[model samples]
Target: MNRLSVSRLFHLNNRKLFQALIARYSVDTGSKDYIDGLVKDDNVVVFMKGTADQPRCGFSNAVVQILNFHGVNKFSFHNVLEDESLRQGIKDYSNWPTIPQVFIGGEFIGGCDVMLEMHKNGELIEELNKVGIRSVLLDRIEEEEKK
Candidate 1:
């Protein structure tokens, strides 16, 4: 084959290779439009290892606890383990390899550890306030009592 033909062949094969990999976790997503909508609806969405009530991993559990500590009881959660496609797709969707990934108002906010550090330093509260999810009033009193 001429060099030009070889280049064209490689390009075609590359395209197919890309499609095959992407297809592996591609959801009909049509029937599940709720996935995208829910992620957007909540001011804080956590794609963690499990749900808020029964977090599976230590990291996920800690994250939920941290939010609860601030009196933020409600958050959207996607359990990656429950759905094979979601498990892989979310990693790709967030462009982040780790779980317990937090999303605040349609923005990716890294993982649990990142969140914990931010919380300790008061940045988490700042961010949450920016999004209008203020920590409950009792939370303020409780935190003050601890200090």
Candidate 2:
């Protein structure tokens, strides 16, 4: 082929390839925003289906209770159902496809079932120990019963 003809063909192919990549790699801005918020609020984060006081799902309620039982007095909660973007965004953020996902110190701790298992065997205490939040059930009861 002539040089001009070859250049035209190459340009056309390049444009098509660029368009295809653009179509395939569209960014989900809403989900990205939600995930950023979740990860940033990472000291103790629970991506549950509902609020802390009134958990909307059984699994979430169990998780809240478990954390409370362990005396994790303060924590942040994201209600995934309140925003559809958050529901999907948290899965991406934690790489764990489940609600009631707990994160400690910006790391993926585990889900509700995992938390329960760990709490049962005192494994959760070890994990919390690093952040200086060990289970202090008796201590809390003595000093702070209103929590």
Worst 10 residues of 1 by lDDT: 25-34
The CA lDDT at 136 in model 2 is: 81
lDDT of each: 0.80, 0.80
TM-score of each: 0.70, 0.68
lDDT of 2 by residue, 12-94 (tens): 99999999999745645247564666655757888898899889999999999988888885899889887776687778766
**Residue 70: error of model 2 in Å?**
1.0
The C-alpha stretches of model 1 lying farther than 4 A from their native spots are: 1-36, 137-147
| Candidate maximizing TM-score | 1
How well does candidate 1 score on lDDT at residue 9?
99
lDDT of 2 at 88: 76
